[model samples]
Target: MKKNLLIIPSIIFTFVLLTFFYLLVIERNPSELPSNLLNKDIPIFEAENLIKNKKFISTNEFGNEIILVNFFATWCKPCRDEHSYIKQFNNNGIRVIGINYKDDPKKTIQWLEKLGNPYSDIPIDKHGRIAIDWGVYGIPETFLVNSKGIIKFRHVGPMSKKVFKKINLLIKEIK
Candidate 1:
């Protein structure tokens, strides 16, 4: 009985070790949060435009071409960090809309002016209701939408150079 018990614990230990090794070998980001809104139509939202004198209607703005929606705030360092990649998307002819999440409009405008505005429309989410509707948990979250207004991918947190390349590939893959 003692020998059998020893063998059982040894087997369990080996199994656990192998499991950890397998997880380590996998090409995955442990920090990445899977977006629940993937492959779903973007949530309908309407908000006042920061620059324009009118409200931004989701129905009219989207569904014609590829759109990139970025939840950003002037206070978020990561938002600042990913500004260049966001601009790159805009430069590639993608219509990018920025949801200014709970940020001061004046500060956001100043920041955009300093960093170079990449967004076609800056929607004011003064109370973060729009972000909540879109299932946003963090600042600097980026979503790629197709011509049909369906969200294809969501990247949470600051986008790294690797993520920039990965998103670029996805942009090409989309029609």
Candidate 2:
């Protein structure tokens, strides 16, 4: 009986080890984190505009055209790293709405000035309520929203050239 118990436990351990190795070998994109909001309407939100002296309303901004909704912060290095990619999107005629996540407005303004502002509208997520509502995992999170106001794709972490090309392709397809 003791030998049988030992064999069972060993078999179980071997199975677990094999499963772990299989997962490690499988293809997966770490940046492609699952989001509940995918294929759904963007969360309704209103926030003070960092640049314009007016409120930024979600309903007004999203349904008109395809937009890139980016959650960013001045304090995040990854956000800074992705700024150029964001600018590339803007340069290519993609409308971008940057949600300033838990950051100081003054610092954000200065950062924009230094980096060249790529966002059409800068919405201040002062207390991170907007980010939470969007199911944001971290700074530099980006969502691609269709013209009909549905979220089509989400990417987390700093944008790379590979990701930039992928997003551009997606935009073309979405269009």
TM-score, per-candidate, Cα-based:
0.89, 0.86
Candidates' C-alpha lDDT: 0.92, 0.92
Residues 30-112, model 2: lDDT tens digits:
55669999999999999999989889988888888999999999999999999999999999999999999999999999999
Give candidate 2 regions above 4 Å deviation. Answer: 1-22, 29-32
Model 2 Cα RMSD, 1 decimal? 3.3
Clash pairs (backbone) in predicted model 1: none
Clashing pairs in 2: none
Candidate 1: tens digits of C-alpha lDDT, residues 1-175 = 9999899989999999999999999988887878888999899989999989999999898888999999999999999999999999899888899999999999998999999999999899999999988888888899999999999999999888998898889989997
Error of 2 at 21 (Å): 4.8
